[model samples]
Target: MADYYLAPDGSDSNAGSSSAPFASLQTLLSALEAGDTGYVRGGTYDESGFADGSDQHGTASAPIRLEAVDGADVVFDFGSGDTGGLRLWKCSHWEVRGFTVRNAPSYGVYVFGDSTDVTVENVTVEYSGGDPGTSGAGFHVRVSANTVLRDCVSRYNYDPSSGGGNADGFAVSQATDTVVEDCVAYGNSDDGFDLWESTGQRLSGCVAHSNGWDLDGNPAGDGNGFKLGGGDVPSGGHLVTRCVAYQNRRRGIHYNTAEVAMEVYNCTAWDNPTNFYFTAGEHVLRNNISSQGTVNIQDPVDDAWNSWTLDVGDPDFASTDPSSSKFLHLTTGSAAVDAGTDVGLDFDGDAPDLGAFETDGGQDVTSNVNPVLKAATPTGDGDLAFTAGTLHYYDGSRWVAPPVSYYDGSQYLTVSEGVQTDAGLVDGFERGDLTPYAGDLGSFNVSTDRAAEGSNALKTAGGRSAWADIRSTEKAIPHGSTFQARVYFTDAADSAILRFGVADQDNWLGAGYNSNESGIQLSESVDGSWTELGTAQMTPVTGEWMTFRVEWGVDDPDQIRIRCFDADGVELGTGTTTTSANQGNTGYGFEYTFQYGGTGPVYFDDLRIV
Candidate 1:
C-alpha cells in the first residue's frame, strides 16, 4: 500500500510524492496498483482526453481509492472537452469521493465496460454535454454491476441540441445491483434518474425536483423524475423507498415499458404533470402518496393503502410550499397517518404513513399488522372480540355486533367547578347565553348566520380594540391534550388577526389565522412578549370555514403541533414549535383574541377537546 499525490502546480515529470506531486491525475491514476491511495490536492485541473488508467483493476481485499484531500476543494474542469470527463472503463473495486466534475461535452463521470464494486460519494456533477445535438449525462454507468452512489448531486446537465432529451442526471443502463441513496438530482435536462434495462436497483431517500427542463425553460426530454425502465429487455426488480419527486415537467415516478415487477414503498410524488405513471409493469405499490397531479395507473399492478386508492382525500401535508423543506411530510390528524398496512417496513406509528416522510416524529411501533377477518363465528365465551373490523361481544347466548364508536363531536370537554351540559363542558354558544365565559363577553354573541355543525355559532364584534380577547371559563384540559375547533372568516379583505389558543395568566400558547401575513401561525407568549413559532402560507377566503387542531406536548413536554384544514377537509398547512409556556397549570382554557383592526367579524364554533 502506497500513497501518491496530484496537484495542479507540480510537473508531470516530478515524483508522485507529497513534496513533489505529479501535475496531472493521469500520472497518479496510471501508477496506482492494488491497495494504493491517491490524494487530489485542492485546485482546478484542466486536463482533457486522458484515458491511461481507464481499464485498471484492483483486488477485493486491496482496492484502489482516489479521493480529494480533507477539506480541499478539488475540481476537474473539462472545458469544451469532447469526451467523458472522468472515465473508469472496466475498473473493479475502485472508490471515488469528494470531487466536482463539470463543463464536459459528454458524461461528467462514466463507469462502463463491466466495472464492478465501484463506489462514488459526495461528488457533484454539473453542466455536462452542453454541446449541440450531443447526448450526455452527469453520471453514466453502463454494463456495470455492484455500484453504489451516495450523497451525490447532479444538476444543470443539459443537451439542448437534442431538445434536452439525451441529458440525464444519473443514467444506469444494463447495470445490476446498483444502490443510489441520499442523492439529489435537480435542474437537469432530462429525467433525474434513468435506469434502462437495469435490474436489482435500490433507490432510497433520494430527491428529484425541477427536472426535464433546459436552462432556457424549454420543455425537453421525457421530464420524468425517475424513469425506472426503458429498453427492449424487461428488466425490473427495483426498490424505491422513502424517495420524493416533485415539480417535474412530466411524470414523477414512471415505469417506462418495463414488464417485470417493481416495488415502490412510502414514496411521495407532488406537482408533476402525472404523479405515478405505472402502465406497463406489474408493480407492487404500498404506502405511497401522490398530490396535485393526475394518477395514471393500469391494471395488474398490486397496489393497496395508497393515497389514490383510498376513499379518503389528500394526506394533509404539513406544507405544500415546495420551496419549504417539509414539502410532503404528513401532519397530525392526517388521513394518511397510521392508515397504511404493514409492508415489512419500519414505521413511526401504529402503521406506516402513506408518504415519503413519517409524521409521528420517531415514535416506536410495537406491532403493526392488519386486522384479520374471522369468517367463523365465536364458539365459546370470551371468543368474541374485534372480528372483521368490528367489535362483537357475546350476550351469553349469541354474538352481538356493537356500533363502532367514531368521533361524533363529543368528548373530554368538562369543567370541575362550573356548569356542564350534555353537549360539552365548554359553551358551544347554543343556549343563546354567555355563562361559560368570564372575560370580554360583551364583545361576542351567538349568531344564527353559519356554523360548522349546528345552526348557530358565536360571532365576534367587528370593532374590538387591539389585543382584546375573550376567555372561556376554567375547564379541565389536561397537559399534553389536544383541542379542535372550526373558525370562519367573514371578510377576506380584512387585515385583522383572528387568534385562538389556550392561555393562562402568565403564559399563552396558541395558533391563529393572521390575515396581515396571509398565513397561519403558531406562537407562544411568556409574560407579555409574543414570539412566533412557525408559519405557513394560506389565503383567507371569505366564508371559508377552516378547522384548526392544536396539540400540546406531542413530541415532548414543551413541544406543540398545529394543523389547519380547508373547507373541504383538505389540509392547507401545518406548523410545529416548542413552547416555554406552562403546561398542566390551572386557569388554562380556550382564548380567542382580536389583534389589530378589521371591518368584518370572525366566527368560532364546534369547539371540542379531542
Candidate 2:
C-alpha cells in the first residue's frame, strides 16, 4: 500500500518516490503490489522499455492503479514494431487511466488470458496497427470478466494485409459482465466496436462513426459501426442502450449471425449505407431510430416503438459530425423527442427520446411527484395504505393500487403527460399519395428514398424548362399565417427554387430560394409585378436537407418574415421585409422549380401551416 513515481529523467535504481522517481514504468510496475498506485509523470514512455503486466496481480478491494499525475499528458508511444503498448496478461483488479497510447503494431492496450476487474478510463488509443500481416485493435480485451471501459476514444487503427479484415477500435471477446460506456470510436479501418463470443456485455452512451475506412479515405475494410456478434458463436444476452452509429461504410449497427438474445434500446443509426442490419439473432429492439439506410432485420425478433415502423421524421440530431461533440441531441421539433417507451429510465419528457442524446428543454416530471408520501392507514372503508413506495386503496374488500401497467403498456405511476403531437401539420406526406397536389410541367411522385417524416415524401422532377413547379390543389391561406416545410435536395441544381405560400400565375406572395446563388428570396407579386423584398445567403449542401419557414403578413399585410434551418434545426439565416400590400389571396401551396435540365430531384416533407 504505497505510492510510487515514474519519470523519464530518473534512474531505475532510484527510490521510486516523488522526488527520486523510478526512471522506467517497468521498474515501477514490477514493484507495485496490491493497493499500490503508480503516478506517471508527463513524458513519452517509448515501447523499447515498457512495462508488462503479465505477472502483476491485485485484489478486488485493493486494485493496482497506474494514473497520470495531476492530469498530466502521458504518452505510450509503441512506435511501429512493438506488438502492443500496454499488455496486461492474466492481471486482475488493475485500473489504467488518462493515457494516450499510439502506433503499436498490434494493439494499443491488450488485456488477455482470463483477466478480471480491469478498468480503463479516460484513455485514447490510436494508430495501433501498421503491420500488414497482423490484425490490430486499439483496445483489445479477451477472456476478461467484470471489465469496464469508459470515457475512452479509439481511432485510426488498421490492418493493411487483409484490407483491414481484423482491425477494430475496441473489441471484447470471450468476456462476461463487461460494460463499455461513454466511449467513441471512429476512423478505424474495421468495425468501431466489436463484441465477439461475449456474454452479459452492456454498451451504453457510446458513439461510432465513419469507421471501416483507411487513413487515405479508401473503403478497404468491413465497416460495421458496432458489430455486436458474429462467427457462429453463442454470444447471448447483450444489452446496448443509447448508442449512436453514423456514417459508417457498412451497416451502422449489425448483429450478424449471432444466434443469441440481444437487446437494443434507444439507439440511433444514421447516414450509414445500411443501418440496423440484424441477420440471425433473437433481438429485442425498442425505440430505436434508423434515419438513412436499408434496414434489414430478420425474424424471431421483438421490435417495438422503433422509428422504422412509425411515421417518424428526420431525427434532427444536434450535430451529425462528432467534431461538434453534440452528435445526437434531438432538436426542439424533432419527431424523436418523447417518442420512446418509459422503461424505468431517466427521461426529460413524458418518455425517453428515441436516440442517444435527449434534447435539453424537455420537462422532467419525475421530480414533481413526491417519492415519499404519507397516507392514512386503512381502518374501515375507502382508506389508503402507503407501504414500500406503493399506495393501496381499500375497496372494502381488498387493497388495490390500480393495475401497475396502464392500458398503453406504461407504468401507472411513472407515466407522465401524453406524448406531444405536432400542431398545424398541413401535410406530412405520410398519406403516400400525390393526388392532393398538382404538378405542372414537372413530374410529382411519392418517394421513399428520403423523407423528413414518415415513409413517403413528395418527390419533384423538374422538366426540361425552368420554373417547372408543383403547386397544392386549393388550400386557403389566412393573413399572418406561418408556413414551413422540410426540403431535401438529391443533387446540386444551379437554379432550383422551392416556394411556399399563397400562389398563382399572377398574384403570389411567398418565399423561395435561388439555388444558383445559394440565397433565400422573399418576393411578392402585385398585379403580376414581382418585387423581391430581401435576399440572404443560405447555401445548403447538395444531397442534404434543410428547413424553410415563412411568415406572411406579420405586423402588416405586406410584411413578411423568412427563416431557414440546416438539418440540425439551427437557424442558418433569416430576413424580414415589407412589400406592397396584397392580402386578398385564397389559394396556398408549395412550388418547386429546377432548371439544370431537370436532371436532379428534390423532396419535400412535413409541410405545416400555423
Candidate that would win on lDDT: 1
Cα-based TM-score, every candidate: 0.59, 0.59
Please write out the lDDT profile of model 2 over residues 1-610, one tens digit for every residue: 9999988898888989999999866787788888999999987777652347876788989999998875365777777354556778888999998777877887778888888899998788877786655567898888878889987878788877778877899999888899998787887899999997776799987778779887655786789999988655687678998888888899899886667788898888988999898766578888899987878877777777888877686777665533233445567788888888875567776778776665547422222111223345675678776533344578789865532211110001221123223436667765345433444624677778888886888777545455555555334355677877787766555334444444455566667566655677777767668787778877665567788787877677777888888888888778788865556554455555566433557777887775
List, residue by residue over 1-610, the lDDT tens digit for candidate 1: 8899999888889889999999987788898878899999987788776333577777899998999976466778786456647888889999898778877777788888989999998788877885563467888888989999987878778886788898999998899899998777877899999988887799988878778987545688889999998798867789998888988899999988877799999898988989999876679999889888988888888877899898546777877754233456677778888888787877776777887777675322211111122244574885754333445678789976543211111111212112223433234565444433545667777788877765778777656555445554333355566766777866664432323334443455667666656777777667667887877777765677788777777568887777888788888777777765656442333344445444557777877667
Question: What's the distance in Å from true for residue 402, model 2?
Answer: 52
Pick out the ten consecutive residues of candidate 1 with the lowest summed lDDT: 405-414
lDDT of each: 0.72, 0.72
Worst 10 residues of 2 by lDDT: 405-414
Model 2 CA RMSD to the hidden true structure, in angstroms: 18.8
